[model samples]
Target: MTTLMEKAHAGVVTSEIKRVAASEEVNAETVRKLLADGFLVIPKNINSKSEPIGIGKLMRTKINANVGTSRDNVDIETEVEKARTAEKYGADTIMDLSTGGDLDLIRRRIMDAVSIPVGSVPIYQAAGESIGNMSSDDMFNAVRKHANDGIDFVTVHAGVTQSSFERLKRSDRILDVVSRGGAFTISWMKHNCMENPFYSEYDYLLEMAREYELTLSLGDGMRPGCINDASDRAKFEEFIILGELVKRAREAGVQTLVEGPGHVPIDEIGLSVTAMKHLTGNAPLYLLGPLVTDIAPGYDHITAAMGGAVAGMHGADFLCMTTPSEHLALPDVADIREGTIVTRIAAHAADLTKEGVREKAREADRRMAVARRELNWNRQFGCAIDSEKAKMIHARSRNADTCSMCGELCSIKMMREVMKK
Candidate 1:
């Protein structure tokens, strides 16, 4: 029952390692070394038939799109469409954060709808019954159920312990907590006057993870909800505990990813990303928006993209997409597609400045530049993030050599004639 990390440590280059190596364009041995050192993780459960996705140092920063059913809106077909749309646009992964209506069925349906690795917050399922009714066993059982159902990874807020709670009480913040899982953990602890089961019984959780080779995503329960609350004591306290848990999970040979903040200002995003990586021993960091500004409701996706680019440049490994409906209501399929494409643009922008993947990232831009110079509209469209949209936009111009704005006065065309003279 050796986990993927254990296999990597044993120097066994399994098929997963090979596939990730080929996809990431890194050597298989290098991938194994990084995984063994806990700097990389491939979130593929033993029962999942989904493709392996590498998230960590040396790999391109990946984007994750969340699709699920809320209590008020439980349309399974729409959720499934959202999942498909997310994947089609460029989401490296999918996380089903559905908190309402036949969760198990919704989860299975979403998983069946896509071939990419899928993750979930098991607490969402466990806390559905009622925070008061949720026992420590119920928490652990929910995790096991998702793993058994072939969830590639699960977000566990194991850092929301009694000690972290003390720090939260001491802080004076605008938004105390914005994470649903975090709130649930705190409420459950308050109800039973007990520590979080995920934190208290982490070893038992590790045992189950090893059995299923589950990649545990340590959720950032105390993540800041606003710019003012950035880098608070409560958040760091949780990171300290998560760092220790990360070391233990590595020892137990379970792959792990550490989640990061939600609404950090643009300036603090760098420090926040750096500190989390340092504290967690460079475990792959999966970040929510860490949105630069809190004011944009309809355009939060763009806000998050700005923050994500900076965070990715600063070493954040994975980004969770923030849709246009982030603060509004349930996102439709169009919202999912736009969010996915926008976040991908951010990820690619980050890769251009990133260390390991900079050359590859720049290569794509170089190709586009060459096509532009040659007035190759088709090639430019081919290189675009949204080829269909690019083609559609250009189709309106009718001038194939130059766009509507510049037309016959295009600099690229003008320069070519000037050079010939």
Candidate 2:
């Protein structure tokens, strides 16, 4: 069985590529060429039996919603509801980061509930079990189990090597290590006086990913935690290793996506995207928030959306949403909706920078302008990404001919009336 990359290399267009192209509004041949060249990835494991989603160059920006239970919360039904809600609100992909309850059952239930591609970080399970006793074999087994369970992709932090840890130690930053998986691996490696299992045995992991046709999202284990830590030695060092691993994975017939920073300032976001693209040879760059600010705890979703919009516009292929629950606790249904919708807004905003995406957005905006001029509040609300929110907000102002904020000063209506004379 040819992997997507292998099939692209062989000049055969896979069904996944066609489906992705159609969804992304790109030429099938274009997606094929990008896949063949390792510049794009369509992460749909052959065993997944889920709808394929594309992430990479020249495609519309994609958003991924992280849903799952932590040690504190472990209700499978609630997690499943979150998954369904994520899909409903427009998450192109979902990652099950459940570290609590029956891990396998949670994953299976989430996968069963949604048709979108589902991903998982296997190390979470490995670390969850023994906490301190998990060996390299334990980590490997966890990965194999996820693959066998048909996870579309697995985020393997195969970049944090012994040498990288040395750099991390030598160069301190505001946030030493922001990634949960990275912290787990680094602690284990330091305690065991050994290298990270995922780093040391990456090929073995790649072979497993290949057998199941799973894409490896090279996790940014040393991602910056604050603006002060953005793009420091530890972050770049891990990226260098990730670049090498990406080449190795593609060579071995496994798809790969490169994960990026945690918290980055507005000014540094574009550079981070460019650096990751250059380092990973343009393999789909999946970024987490690159959260522009550290101060907004309850409103990290907005911060993430702001950063996600910039990252996507600059070159980040996939945006991982930071829910309102981020830095606090697990999100409920409302948080899920808020996070997904905000991230979608970011994705669409970024899409405007793409070739035809602006035209689409401009068309919508034009319709909005016309709607306001005609006092068509229904059309104005209908054109909104969150129509329910728009309707509610509009209704709260007594359904005024003009929005409450600018009621008597409605620009379009005023301008039209002035022009009529």
Candidate 3:
């Protein structure tokens, strides 16, 4: 089975490259080169009906909205709606992290609901029999199942091995492990008295990936759970391992994306990003919030957006949306919408600073600036990321042209008059 990366390396630009090139506004050669070098990835499974999305170098920093059913809350329809809602609100992709209610059905329904690429954590399902009962086969089986179901990418916490576990024990971490998949892998290893199957038998995983043309997302299993635990030895240890795994995957022609730390302070984000990129040879860096702070539980979405923008500026290629209910409960459709839009804003904000795509991103801002300056409400709405919301908020104003905040005292309006002279 020839994978896209292998094809690219062989100097064959497939249709996927052509489509992504047109969408990202880069020439097909650029995408091909980046994919061949393992610096970018297009996570399209052979069976996936979803349109291809290019992630990594020279592409717009993308947003992923996670929709899934919790054990306490299992509504297939709701989960599917959440997926659609996220896509409608500008999420670049969706990850079905469901741990409840007929996982296969929930996963398939979510995929059918959206045209964007879908991703998942296979170990979550493997742990359905409880952590203690999961055999190594269970883990691999779940991965193969999801891949067969057209999961474009899968987050395999292959870094959480016996070696990394030793480092974690040496480190004095407060939250210890916040990643459920990481916790599961560690627990299973401790119980079975063997190394993580994903690591010990990584060649097998790579074989399956190549067979399915799957993109491996090297999960940051030991990622910092809070700012206090940010960039610790354990985290870096995992990065080192993931870096090795990334090279192995590339050699096998299986495209890969490296996931980064979830909770990091604003000051240290650059360091975390740089280290991960360096260690992993700059494989497409997919990041969870890297939420700057842990105290704002309810407004974690905003907290994450603040951190996401900074992380993107520092070379994060993808930002996973965090909702207001992030630290609370299963997010509904409304939460998904809010989170997707907020994360998209952060991605766009970062694009304004990123290379290769900055000028194109800036041109969009220029259009909005001109619209605002001319007080073209309709044009301004047209340029908005969420024109419906913009129009709604603008409709609240007593003045027809300017918004309620400044009204007739609007700076743009005043500036327009000033410029006329």
Return whichever of 2 and 3 wins on TM-score: 3
lDDT (Cα) of model 1: 0.94
Query: Could you give the candidate ranking by lDDT, starting with the highest?
Result: 1, 3, 2
Output the worst ten-in-a-row residue range by lDDT, candidate 2: 354-363
| Better by lDDT, candidate 3 or 1 | 1
Task: Note each model's CA RMSD in angstroms.
Answer: 1.0, 1.6, 1.0
TM-score list, all predictions: 0.99, 0.96, 0.98
The collision pairs in model 1 are 262-290
Q: Which candidate would rank higher by lDDT, 1 or 2?
A: 1
Q: Comparing candidate 1 with candidate 2, which one achieves the higher TM-score?
A: 1
Arranged by TM-score with the best first, the candidates are 1, 3, 2
Please, what are the lDDT tens digits per residue for candidate 2 over residues 83-164?
9999998999999999999999999999999999999999999986665898889889999899899899999888988998
Kindly list the per-residue Cα lDDT of model 1 for residues 48-129, writing each as its tens digit.
9899989999999999999999999999999999999999999999999999899999999999999999999999998876
lDDT by residue for model 3 (1-421), tens:
8889999999999999999999999999999999999988999999899899899999999999999998999999999999999999999899999998999999999999999999999999999968998999999999999999999999999999888999999999998899989999999999989999999999999999998889999998898888889999999999999999999999999999999878999999898898889999999999988899999988889989998999899899999999999879989888998999889999999999999889999999999999988889999989999899998978889897778897778988887788895
Best by lDDT: 1
